[model samples]
Target: MRRFFYTIDSDNADAPLLPKLSELSQGSDIELPDSIIHHWCRVLRANVGDQGILFDGFGGEYQVQLQTISKKKAIATLLLHLDDDRTAPIISKIGLVMSRGERMDYAIQKATELGVTAIQLLSSHHGEVNLKPAQVEKKLAHWQQVAIAACEQCGLNRPPLILAPLSIRDWLAPTESPNNKTAVSPIVSTLSKDKYYQVLESAADLRLQMSVPAAGQPAKPEILETVLKQESPYIELLIGPEGGLSDDECQKAESVGFAPWQIGTRVLRTETVPVVALTTLLALYSYNK
Candidate 1:
């Protein structure tokens, strides 16, 4: 079934009276985004008295009846507070190096569709395009459109948060948030003097960038799984560019204690590692689920 979710203003309580009146009651007026208005009002042929889902994050979904309609305006009133059917357990987040051209777009779309909760774009030393503020804003807007399109197609009602543009270095530095949020860095590795991976870490769990070699001639998957077992409490993937991390960058990462382990006998593309890492952890986490 096609599913859509929206938040309703609690001050308006007429939504709950829909079923009793047998007519949709138009309540709070919300400004629908242009693209959505086109689709919902025109393409979907959604008219007054039609049903949809609306809710607060309070865990119950409000079954709503569409109350009013016009060329560019519509509203839905809450009907029944139905419990949600699906649940997403994994709190997956990706920290990606900005790839050039359409590849970055493709990665973000795929990653969001795959259920990433947040997407953080990082500019690494190996990044190909240097951005001015305007350029970054332009790209972020495009990226958000891509995410919304993915949500529409993938049935993801809750859109993932797209973080502000940041560099690998600046993103790693500690700072205060308006919400009184604590410092959070996701990328981690095993300790190794040679391989560079640790451009990101947290004070509580500082050992994220190390790669652990297996006890025997283990499979690549097996080695990664064993290594993740020793993960320092959190897992934030740090993916480098096509040319890979620079020697100096790698050395700097290593100085902060990144464990560099081999993924395979062959080299993976810039976009491939993070995808694999996401799937791998999801699979591992699913086993316990």
Candidate 2:
């Protein structure tokens, strides 16, 4: 069946309320938001009896049939709740240095499609783009929308959490308590050697450094594969912007336990690294299983 997925904004209480997956049963009528109604009626030219899927972003999804369609609103009747879990077994978070325009948007979309659990926008010394406080708020919302759109298209019921942009220094700052947040393996892309060995030795979680190596140097996918074998439930990948991380920034990351690692021999663009790295990690995960 052609499954069209729509995400319900649980935060928007003003919208028509839909039953939770646990409370949902067959033959219950539910009203879809006007935005979804417009897409179905105006964009897709869906008829009254068209069928699609609805996900609340909690987990799982529902089979729904369009029972009523009009210029103002549309209603669907919930048929069944499919308890399929589509979440990735390994949680991946990408800490990306802000890039220009569509490049950042593309990274967020593709990363969500690759099943990243969260995205942290970071500012680096070498990054080309800078945002004021207002711009940060706006960009955070924009990137979040991009993630949601990616989820709707890619069959991900849960979208990655989009964090507000922070400077690289602030991002690496130690929190007062480690138990306050979920544990994550920290991997960073760098070429620094000063603290590399120490970071690797002390790393309790999987840490990666992605770099394009010099000629005759071996690729480190094998190293990344070995780290993945450690089976950390969550990993946070750090990729730099434009010119990549500066020397000082690399040192700071290493101080925070971000082990550096390289991918292939060729340099990947700022936006391209997330897609390539995520695909490699996900592929390695499946291969190991």
Quick one: best lDDT, which candidate?
A: 2
lDDT of 2 by residue, 96-203 (tens): 998998998999999888888777788889898878966765677678778777877888876677766777777777364343332211111111122311222232
TM-score of each: 0.65, 0.81
lDDT of model 1 at residue 162? 54
Candidate 2 positional error at 284, Å:
1.9
TM-score of 1: 0.65
Predictions in order: lDDT:
0.52, 0.69
Off by over 4 Å in 2: 1-19, 174-204, 212-223, 230-232
Put down candidate 1 lDDT per residue, 252-274, tens digits, no spaces: 55565444544555667766665
Global lDDT for candidate 1? 0.52
Model 2, position 139: C-alpha lDDT score = 70
